[model samples]
Target chain A: MQQRGRGRIAYPYIIWMAIFIVVPLILILFYSFTEGDIHNLKDLKFSVSSYKKVLEPIYLKVIGNSFVLAGISTLICLIIGYPVAMIIANTDVKHRNLLLMLFLVPIWMNFLLRTYAWMSLLSPNGLINRLLLWLGLPKIEIMPGKTAVLLGMVYNFLPFMVLPIYTVLSKIDKHVIEAANDLGGNSVITFIRVILPLSVPGIVSGITMVFLPAVSTFVISGLLGGGKTPLIGDLIEQQFLSSRDWHFGSSLSIILMIMILISMAVMSRIDKSPPEEERRKI
Target chain B: MSKNLIELKNLTKRYNDMTAVDSINLTIKENEFVTLLGPSGCGKTTTLRMIGGFEDPDEGEIFFEGKLLNDVPAYKRNINTVFQRYALFTHMNVYENVAFGLRVKKVSNDEIDRRVKRMLKMVDLAGFEKRNVDSLSGGQQQRVAIARALVNEPKVLLLDEPLGALDLKLRKEMQIELLDMQRSVGITFIYVTHDQEEALTMSDTVVVMNKGVIQQIGTPEDIYNEPINRFVADFIGESNIIEGVMLEDYKVSFDGLVLDCVDKGFALNEPVDIVIRPEDIRIVVNPDEGMIKGTVTSVVFKGVHYEMIIESDKREYLVQRTVMFPEGSVVGMNVQPADIQVMKRGDVPCSKEEEEG
Candidate 1:
């Protein structure tokens, strides 16, 4: 009886999604073909010239750099986040809930605001540099560079990596771990062979998160990386803001969107693979 | 050579306030299968985990073949465990899961393959090497867990209720399978469970425990026939413990009846509990001939036999016999001198320690 109205209940959400997401995306696709600015373009002419402009080396270089930055940040996040998550998940029962909340709390902050906050703490006159100068340390020009961008990428994505990995680690039965030790697989061996492999789903989820956001984000690069080091997001934003070429920006956005879709498709393929089961026969 | 394969000397584990295992001193022999029998939270699993080096006893030293195991980590220990939840590798296929320990030890690929296959076949799971373990049945997963542990061929096999996850029929089947495997391998098995029947049926030695203390450790028959205290007699099987007074060295007065028991060194007029297994008491059809007269209050029809509860002097005593008695059969219950075993009241570690200074 309760299941009878399920489709009707979901009808409103579907209509709202079509109006907000699907229609806007279709408009973006259609706008990529429009020619010239509105004042000069009394009659709109549809053409593929905007797409040709997106294929230029300047735009492609930033896309490539975005991939490299996202890749590096993902690697660093996994290395740092996995162990922290593991310690939290497997440690004393009394403190686990608190640890989980602490890790999760940072995500509630606004993404753009957090990136700017890092800028204040990383600049030459920022607290971090001021501390180094006070300590009689060499002046470090660390802020407003590729390093800052990478750091921001990792910072924003660390929780995404940690939460999934922590969940998987917590679900791991300690009994299986004991069994591994009993079978002569010590700490290192057990972690590498059993724990690591079983946690691929979480790792993959983490990687996707850090990689996708880092690759597409302009806000961090603009605030911390400075305008000199262009990324795909910054390059796309420039076409609309400074260059005033809406069609070209739309084409670049389409390319970035396609890349995201491709990666998502690959992740879905992996996610559909076999579930874990340890077969015991008697 | 030291006959004992593993020994726990005054082992105790305390967690801030609660002591999980308290001074448990046990010895297991080479090639002998033993079961630590107790209810949940009774430190049986803690005891097994300590033996496997997964847990460290707070106040004891462990010895394996005369080698001290104190401070030894789990991996360095030469033991394998079949975990209660199977604990089979979730990510790896059955073959890889079984082959994992060998790979870690850098065994030759050919040899690892041979050993994994042999162990898998031994568990009756041939042709399942490539199949993902998650795709298998519960019993199949359990077999993989066993194969994974057994393939390593460690000195001792620690199983913490390995068969507890299975259905009743599967559990029974696995019991036979486990016994067969144990016989063939000749490896010492330290099985932990709360099941009395499983322990009685499979273990060469059974250790009964309750509330962080070992009650008795002996062969199945020894534990069954000569339970050291009231808990053991009650735990292993149903026992009618009657409150009595020790009239002499081996004589006790139980309610309006006096019976000769085989116990010594009790003070005169000392309060005691005489424990008698239901099967030990015999039922006679003639009400006048037996030592104690009673009427059948209820007759239970157990398959292949009948168990009757006898009521005499407002007290109930169970008497199990092959012959079925009618619902209202007026019968007599008697016991031979050899069958009536007696122990001091509240002698067991668990039940009688309610109020202590």
Candidate 2:
């Protein structure tokens, strides 16, 4: 009875979720299946035309580009962030917190502000080109393209990758590593045979955290890509706001959600498989 | 006599201002079950780690098989350790954990499989090859850890209190199994533990330590019957340690009574510490029939024996006997000459002072 009474305290939160989250999702589902004025219930008629339009070549390309760019950005973050996390975790306690704080300092600022800061640096007459010219290097052209967009995604999401991996790596028992050394494993071999396998759960969560945000970000593509590269996120935004095509936008949003759910399912499977089974497959 | 497998020449380790292991020399023979036994922070584990090549001694040399091993890394040394917590890799299965060392050396698949299977079988976990390490109980994980280290067949196995986490009954059972395994394997085992009984039960030689220094190194019988100091006597088992004066060879005087003892080599009238084991003190029904008389203060039933505390000359003596002496009853306590152990007074504080401190 006490547990039941305590559970009632969550009723307010449940109602808030129903009104804010569940209602919007249901409206989007309804919009995806109907055509006509959204404000008028009688004018809305059931239709599959928005779903059919999603299958078009142009829209499919936008969806494909979003996934490819997000995948590359997530990979870059893992490559750069993993070593940084390991270094931070291995440092003595006196400096570990300071290093972690430094890594998180940039994240405290607004996300959009950070992306806009990248734009000013990557522009044609930007600080980067000025520094390159001063160093006797040729000016490079990288902005207003997928490369700039990818850079923005990686820069914005690198901390997401590092934090979880650091938490896991730091929690590993020192004795386990010592045991590995006692079992004739050198530093490099011990990392492969023990530490890396143990940190897979962190890697999976890091991938999800970085990839989900990178895939759906419209601000980075807008500011860095200079309206030249349009991803699925930009396409969906244009449909709802500029084109006034809520039906097509809702359909695209549903597809993106399904895609994310599928990727998450795959990531969880990788996390759930025992490290021994993973080795056998290799 | 067997050959000396490992030797420590004044090994010492320090952590900043505090010394963890003081300068101490030791020799461990091949095929010997040696236990570095002591209370926590007594440097037993630190000494074991130095031998395992996990910790480098600040001052002194380690000789393994008569070779200088000062600069040898842990991985390069031909020794393995079963950590106190077992330290089994949680990401791996039982088979993979046992096969870890073999795979590190690039042993053939068939050889690894055969050796891992045999090791698991030896630890009595034959069919648990594919079981996840985290799924096992504490005892099973302990067995897997032992299997993992033993499969490598290192010349020496350093077990850092392998049974410290088990229940009392399981610990007792594992003690017997470990002794049997050591005999069958025929390798030197350097075990570290704070439990004196476990050390006495399993070790061929027990090195009793206190404050980073070895107090005594001897067989269980020798350490019990012939402790060299007050610390060893108080640590190994229940004992009534009292200050006494040596009258001459084969005699000592304590509490205004001269008693016959089997210790000598001390100068006449030298102050010494006398150790009388609780079980060694016999209670006589007739007060005058014994050497000393005291009133029984308390009695406690301890399964196999009755433990009684007797007050004589304002000093309490702990006595263990099969027969119960009721409280407030006057009794005579007698100790044989052989059971009375005497040693020169050392710097270690007495049990009473230690408790007060």
Candidate 3:
């Protein structure tokens, strides 16, 4: 009886997933294997042309560009986020909560609005250049280029990196750190040996959260890369919206889905270590 | 001349307006196993941290082998601590955790391997090196922590309630193991705990503390028999503490009866506290042979003895005897004059102090 009741309570979520998630994914798979759009499904003919097009040098270059830009943004976020997490985690309770709240306040706004906010700061004659010229410095051009897209991605996804790492760092036992000090490990050695290794799960999750969206994002690249440097996301969008090649777009979407699954598999593999009590029971 | 391994001269520590450790002086000799025994918030841990260089004293100096060491950081100090929760490195296996201190010192691989194996064998964890620390039980983790700290071969070892996490049976076993380890290592061990039995069983000297101050420092026998104040008497073990008037040297009055005791040097008619161990009172069958007559209100059969609460004319007394007595039965209680311990009244008069003895 209890099992049936639980099943009933989960009915809504199950139905929602089947309709909004499973059905669309199946439709995309079917479209990727066929030669035409799905509106006239009965007349569609099966072919492998879409898959072959994905291997062509033009599409491969776009995928490579996407990987490089996303990888750079993820690296920048990790380098900048880890220290911010450590500082917040190490502060006293009263100040730690306040600092974490301040870090999260910017993320409360819409991601699009926040990206536009960065655009205003980075554009040529925008707030940053105006301030620099007023201070007797030459105005520099960074917007409408690869730098702008990388900066926007990092700025938007930074909190995703910081929050997980902070949660892990804060949950670390203070006694463990003290034990390291007691064992004659100085600050640097203690961090490298104890703190960094323990924070691996959080770092892995942060990488997944940042890298996936950075690889498949269209808005940031469209606005900041200024139609010159097209990522895989832009190519898919162009194929589906302008060129009316739904099969090619579906193939790109399938490849993006595979990349996401691979990242998810990596995250789950690192998270597979059972908690201490459960391991003992086993 | 004797060697003093560590000395604290008027050491003090304060947090905000509350003084965690008051101005206190202590001397630890070479290779001595000393324990700080007290209840919670009694500054035992604060004092230990100061000795380990985890905290600095606000007002005086710490000396190591006649050299002042007030400014040295914890990593530079020649001491290691086994924390209360064991603090075993969860990311490392037992072998790696025990080898951490040696690796930090840049020891060679052969030497590290030899020392790690020897220490593990000393802790009776010889074949468990490859096991993850998290998979081990609480007692095993504690042993690994000991091996980790001892491998460094520090001049002193500090343990802060290291047995607080184990079961009762495991705690008892660990207590004996820890004492043996201390003796074999021949290093000064400064252990902190609130368990009087643990302190009495292991230490060469017990420093009793209360309310951020040192109450008394002596051997186990001295602490049990000659508690300088009422707090020491009540905190250390079970005691029937009662109020009394010191009539003169070697004479005291309580419960409308005067008794002769071994204490002296108090003013005539000075109000004082007296402690009598429960086991010291003898239960007699005949009222004529006993000093006080009472009826047994409650009786509980403990493992080795029967603890009975007797209500006399003046007050109630907790008496422990080997034989059982039925509840609501009339009984006679007798006490010897030598068993009556006299002490000075410490702090203010509280209700807990004025209860039945």
Candidate 4:
């Protein structure tokens, strides 16, 4: 009877999630394969045309460009953030909390507010252009292109990259580092054998953090990419908002979800590829 | 080869406002297993760290085989340390962990393989090469740490409480294994531990320290049987300390009993502290015969011996004898004059006081 009561209490939260989350996901999935247009859904019609139309040459490039931007951003973040996280985690300091807080300062503000600030800085008379002009250098055009899109994405996404790497770095034992040194490893060798392998979990999390958002970022592309190239994110936004074609938008959303799962599957496979020895310690 | 493997001269370390290690001078000879024994915060680890070049002394010179190691970093020094926490690389497999030092020196891959295998075999971890370090038990992990340190073939292996993390049964087992490994390797080892039993069981020489100062340096027998002070005696083992006085050269007086103790060179009637080990005190259980009449207050049987608390002159003294004595047995205890250790208070060295027969 007591077990039944406890089970009843757990039922409501699960029921709430199923009603709110499961119902919408099922509706989206149902519309993804059915015939529809900008005006209204053509009922009693089932066709693969809606799914197939998501693959026009322009939309394909959008998907390709999104992957390039998010992938490059994630790679760069790994190179820059890993070292910074190591320095933060390994440093013996009295004011470590302050240093860490300084690293996380960008996270405290609203995401849209931060993006707006980036726009103000990257404009023609912004801080970067003015600095260049003051140095008697050419006023290079950096905004409203692939460069602006990448910069905006990186700026907004640095914290996600930093936090996971930091968590894994901090958890690694110092004794292991010393043991590496004791085993005849100098700084370079220690970093390779001890530090790098241990921080793999962080690296995986950081990559996922940067990769997922980089691929689906509609805001940075819309505000910075200047609509020169419609990204997969922009296409989905257009289907939902501009085109008012819920069926087509649902189809695009399903494709994005499928791509994410493929990437995640590839990642977990790569993580599992290294047998026990390579992964056991990492 | 130089006679001494490592030497520290006037070594001192300070942390902001606190002095962790005061000026210390000592020579550790080659192939000798020496221990820096002290209680917590007694500069033993600081001393070991300075030796390993993990820490720099504020004012001192360190010599490794007559070479100055003043500006050398830990990597430059041919010394490996087994940290108290067994600092085995959590991310590396057992084989990779052992091969770390060889790989650091950029040894050939074949050589790294052979040497790592040999060292692992020496530590009795042959088939565990592919196992994750964290998956191993504490004792196995400790062996991996030892294997990692020893594979480097450093001139000196410094251990900071290598067995401190193990259970008592495992710790004792490791102590034996460590001593055997040290003998086989035939390298100078600078071991640091507060456990006097571990120190006494392994070291050829014991360096007792207290409050950032070297109190005494001698063999385990000397430090145990003839401690230089109350601190040395108390720190090493269970010892009874009694406040006494020096009546004349070679004579000390305790309570109303003037006893013949073999320590001297103080002025007449100078107050001194006398230390006697528990087992050294012989118990005489005759109804009418013994040195001083004492009633047995309590007896605690410890497998092979009885820890008896005897009360004489309103002062309780603990005595350990192998005989299984019943509770409340009236007995008299006597410690030989040679067993009585006389020491003065304050900062001072051991005096060569002559004893009068």
For model 4, what is the error of residue B113's alpha carbon versus the real structure, in angstroms, after optimal superposition?
3.2
The C-alpha stretches of model 3 lying farther than 4 A from their native spots are A1-4, A266-282, B328-331, B348-357
* Residue A79 local lDDT, model 1: 97
Clashing pairs in 2: none
Q: Give the C-alpha lDDT of model 2.
A: 0.92
Model 3, span B207-315: residue lDDT tens: 9887688889999989998888888888777888899999999999999988889999999999999999899999888867788889999999899999999999889
Every model's DockQ:
0.53, 0.59, 0.49, 0.53
Docking level for model 3: medium
In the range A28-53, model 1's lDDT, one tens digit per residue, is 78768888664566666888998888
TM-score against native, each model: 0.93, 0.96, 0.94, 0.93
Regions of candidate 1 where Cα sits further than 4 Å from its true position: A1-4, A37-42, A267-282, B347-357
* True-structure RMSD for candidate 2: 2.3
Instruction: Arrange candidates by DockQ, descending.
Output: 2, 1, 4, 3
Native interface contacts kept by each candidate, as a fraction: 0.75, 0.77, 0.72, 0.72
The stretch of ten residues in a row with the least summed lDDT in candidate 3 chain B is B348-357
Candidate 2 positional error at B65, Å: 0.5
Best-matching candidate per DockQ: 2
Model 3 alpha-carbon miss at residue B159, Å:
1.0
Candidate 2, residues B253-307: lDDT per residue as tens digits?
9999999998889998999999999999999989999899999999999999999
Which of the two, 2 or 3, has more TM-score?
Answer: 2
Identify the leading candidate in terms of lDDT.
2
Q: Write the per-residue lDDT of candidate 3 for residues A91-171, one digit (tens) a residue.
A: 999899999999999889998898888878888988999999999999878789999999999988999999999999999
